[model samples]
Target: MNESGNPSQPVNVNEYDASHIQVLEGLEAVRRRPGMYIGSTGERGLHQMVYEVVTHAVNEHLAGHADTIDVTITADGRIRVADNGRGLPVEVRESTGMSAVERQLTELSFAPKPRTGYWVFGGINGLGLCVVNALSSRLTVEVHRDSHRWTQEYEKGIPISAFTRHEESSGHGTAIAFMPDADIFETTRYSFATLSQRLQELAFLNGGLAISLTDERPERPVRHQHLDGLHAYVAHLNPYPSSLVHSPAIGFTSENEEQTIFVQVAMQWNTRPPGEFRSFANSTRTHEGGTHEHGFRTALTAIINDHARRQHLISPDDEDITAEAVQQGLTAVVSVKLAHPVFEGCTRTRLGNPEANTYIQETVREHLAVWLDHHPNEAAAIIRHILNTSI
Candidate 1:
């Protein structure tokens, strides 16, 4: 207003003082801005809450602490997640005199960061159990450990009572049941199909992990476990399975020991478009393909083009096939496990680590080249398919 030569009113500079600097202690920040942590207050966010809890259990399995995870949608609109794993430590903390389980649920500071040489997919966005608890109207946890059973209850992120210990339990594990806060979410109803697809993908992504989804609302239960892992995943995603250029998917894994990164790839070409080309980092789907995807595509195009020229399938003067052409009719899954994966955003939809590119590129280059050279018939068929698609 002053620059425009208009009469300006007196401003209260004191109005923007220390009182405006409100500090949100404990889990209050999550509740004040649920969308900032959960991405939305709609159906997607509701599902994300379920994913966070399930992901925690999956991490246990990834760390070799657990093997089986069971998820149930109760008739009363509550989610129950149980796992056969080493339960959360119940030892009392010296600073707060609270058990580890209570601290994990009540404080956001407990979220673990990506450390060296450990494979985990929990709280990568700095939101996990605590966020789940904050946005939940009612949450209960049961821990079977230390040769005894421990239990606790919370209402709207506040502990209703102290943790109680019971008689010795037979085995060690953790079970959590939570009801999403109606005030925070647009809808508390869970989607069975959406949750099933993700759980199935997780099972395929992490081989030998058993996961079961039970809809207690209707008493429907299904189990998912894949020893063949990504190979089975690619086959399942193939839309043109009958028209595959190769009978079985080509799968391989490579590791960069110094960097502590592991890449696993499974690929199969078909005679159709709109095929699946999925990528994941640290067991989280990278919806927006990032460095890892870039590396995979670059290596694939180079290998195919070089092979075509060497085999005289294409003249030396012919332009190298584009990455798009090489990927046409492709059904592949690229999964990379990095101890310190760098995701581009809080949503974790894109990978950003530069080292991931080199790791995946080299892995694909070496393994794919060998596969093509070993299987001339399948390789030629794949090349022909690409050429036809280009035409």
Candidate 2:
């Protein structure tokens, strides 16, 4: 607010505001600016929408309300996500003056806090459920909670009718049946192999989470399940870590009491220079490294140098190892489970978590350093591997 009855900074054509405010009603804005919500209108964006909704389903499993999640692409261009969770809450919402079932079926954009939103969801944009609904021509949600089975139909994100409950026999989970709106999408169908690989990655990250998919369109459905968690994830990425580590594991975590960020790292260095690194911010893999990654690197370098000094491993005259040198031939995953993951950009590729840097640095510095000392043989083997396995 300003003295002349204007904002402190009067927004001009160059600024964001009233004119910039997108008053997209129904699904018009989604078709126009699909990228803003799904991150793109292309393959990545298309996959994002699927993942967003799937993540919403997964959140229930993460909360112990689910056990099995199945995703499959049907020949008719429908995506079916079935989970053994409690089911989508369908009570009435006092805020929107609509039934909770209606919101889940036709108008959920982002995950709402329980009661406030009435359920746990892992939607990145909050508009995930709604966006998917609005983009698709038809969306249906079936929930079997408390021994009562119910279903709802949505056409382009609008409910054709309120939820109708039936006392028929039903599974004790929730099933969402949706057909991607062909009008909004270039292709309403999905790829089995691509989606399978993604689902595998997620299963690996979540550990003990089982997901199965059957591509009925192909005569036989494609199915996969991973119970190994990150251990399997590490093994999948670097199959020969044990041979390289001289011990059972390659890189390990350093834990401390005042951990402001969850520092979980597993790395296997190969002979490749500038070793490949992957990061995740609260289960969403950050393809682009963020502040958490920065801190992890800093801690990694410091720990190695300190260890070198204690063991007289490196001649004082030798140059300290470079980031590339440390990473060379290494497949490392750093997963930070922060309370709230603030991404650097709208696409959420990088974690813009500032506090993660310091938190990781401190914890790793203390814990990893001590671990290396106790596992002297393993440390020496890794240091040697880094020196030898470079292009």
Candidate 3:
């Protein structure tokens, strides 16, 4: 203050606070590099736009929602997703005292966490909503909860209107309808088969969960199986010409205060194809196969090798039972749980956690070994098949 020897503006405490927090508003960056958020500007990304919208509903389903999701590709080219679950937040902002819905639709980095962790993070990235809104020419979000329905409209993530309460009868859930921006994405159309495939998998993996996918664009609607859950999933995907000893799938699930894990093991001697297994944190597939998958793979390989050596099924000089050699025709699914999910990349969302590896490995190792001992014939057959395949 004395450096200038003038009435140096009395150093004020409030004025000394850190510089104004820098923030990129609206869909500014998303529009600049759409691929950075949605992965690519190709068909995959086009499909991703739909996924981004439907994931919210699927997430609600996981959280014990009202149940039922309706997806329709309107003739007018509007993709509509409706789900029975807690609706997106639309309360008043405590800071600006403005409607939360208005702010989220109009601003960047504005999203509500259903829970502390990304447990309900069905969105591709935290940018799921923003990305979709930014990529769409027009967007509308309707929320039905607490016996009241509210509506809001936006243009590319920027709210154009305030939330309006609608008095609708016999309605509860969230509906999102958006028209993709042709300028932002090359193709704005969606593939029903691809979408159906993903939905069918979710239905199969989640027992007692009913998911329906209908393509109104085509006169003949393609329907998928709604029952059988993971058990059916394994059977359907089981190897062809399998000499299964009839090893029923064993499903194990555990949840801590932070995470939830669901594991299903279906082992049979099949002559169809290579082994297949996947891990999931929430509904999003862990394409890379995280810790839980690692443990499952390791334990399975080790267990098979141990059984083979003890049964004298293979000569001591045989190979070390590589993952590929052992999983020639086996099928299993290992799903992990994480409190705060940190998905890899924006579009290719996969679970990233080290602890899941230990849990899955230990559980499968202890249980599968005992299962093998209990069912000698099945274990021996599998090990023999693996050894034979290796040879």
Candidate 4:
């Protein structure tokens, strides 16, 4: 109590100063907040670590360096990804003063070249490899380039040894093997089904790009590859002839030079109930339909309605066909590649690029209109089916 009999103010035990704050260097920040980088520490995050590494290889393929990527899950729960791409550059980058290999492994802000129409690379945020390194118990990278093979090793994101050069090698590529840290992930073992499904999607999305996933845990290893691209994907989803109302799926590709956008669509009407409408932006699946999907729906509905009206299949006074009605008994795959894609969230399940809406709409409308005109009989059948449902 004070002499004045009033309550005394509490004393400031410690002054606020710079010393109170601590700084985390290297990949320590990633370990501290793993979710911010990989979304979760559960199975999704574990699988995401694998995806991050594979994405780098896929980017190399897109850059015209590689043609095939091989992903294998070893018996010991380690993941090894190898690509026949022009290996990672061994030269030191002036900005960071670290070799490309070292910077990619240790630095969080290190980024490759910006994506362009020539190559639709996926890892734009630059957190891929570093995040994988930070979350792995051990990581080893080998690059075969310039007639020599170079190697480096790291333990939980820290360099265990300096880069070493090996005997001359003829082939060129990059290989990364990593074991997820048991302390960071809920589970270290990976699901073969999940990995295969994702790898197949990547292969389908990038036509001519070969990706193989192999499981070595089983007595007889299982391998999966898809080469027919989206066409095969649509057929795989609806395999039975009884399920498909159309014999052959309608597929097309279109590109906009000005917007630097490329879109591919494969669709077929089925006898079974309406199937899924799968969509992707830059190889990432968008489960929640965004501008790209919206554009697709708009184009489908508009084209169908216009064709029906022209063929006198519907009364002139009838209301325009609803998007849902147009999509009934429809199975479709829509993939778009753009240089600057604005995804809705970190999960990247939705695309928000406004320009994509216009580009996709125009492309679908024009190409589909011509198809409908050329195949009058098939177009009439589809219109009739839709009209019957509308009634």
Q: Which candidate number has the best lDDT?
A: 1
> Which has the higher TM-score value, candidate number 1 or candidate number 3?
1
Q: What local distance difference test score does each model get?
A: 0.87, 0.70, 0.69, 0.83
Per-model TM values vs. the true structure: 0.95, 0.84, 0.83, 0.93
Model 2 regions lying over 4 Å from their true place: 1-22, 93-97, 108-111, 114-123, 168-171, 219-224, 240-247, 251-260, 272-274, 389-391
Model 1 Cα shift for residue 1 (angstroms): 5.5
Better of 2 and 4 by TM-score: 4
Candidate 4 vs. truth: CA RMSD?
3.3
Q: Model 2, 162-182: lDDT tens per residue?
A: 787889655678787788766
Give the candidate number with the greatest TM-score: 1
Error of 1 at 9 (Å): 3.9
Candidate 1 on 190-299: residue-level lDDT in tens? 99999999899999998999999999889889999999999999989885657788879999998786758989999999887846899999888899989999999999
TM-score result, candidate 3: 0.83
Residue range 54-104, candidate 3, lDDT tens digits: 776666676776467777777777888887777767677678876765665
**Which segments of model 1 are wrong by more than 4 Å?**
1-7, 113-126
Q: Itemize residue pairs with steric clashes in candidate 1.
A: none
What is the model-wide C-alpha lDDT for candidate 1? Answer: 0.87
- Sorted on lDDT, best first, the list reads 1, 4, 2, 3
Per-residue lDDT of model 4, residues 13-106, tens digit only: 4655778898977699899889888889999889989889988887777667788898989889899999999898888768866688988888
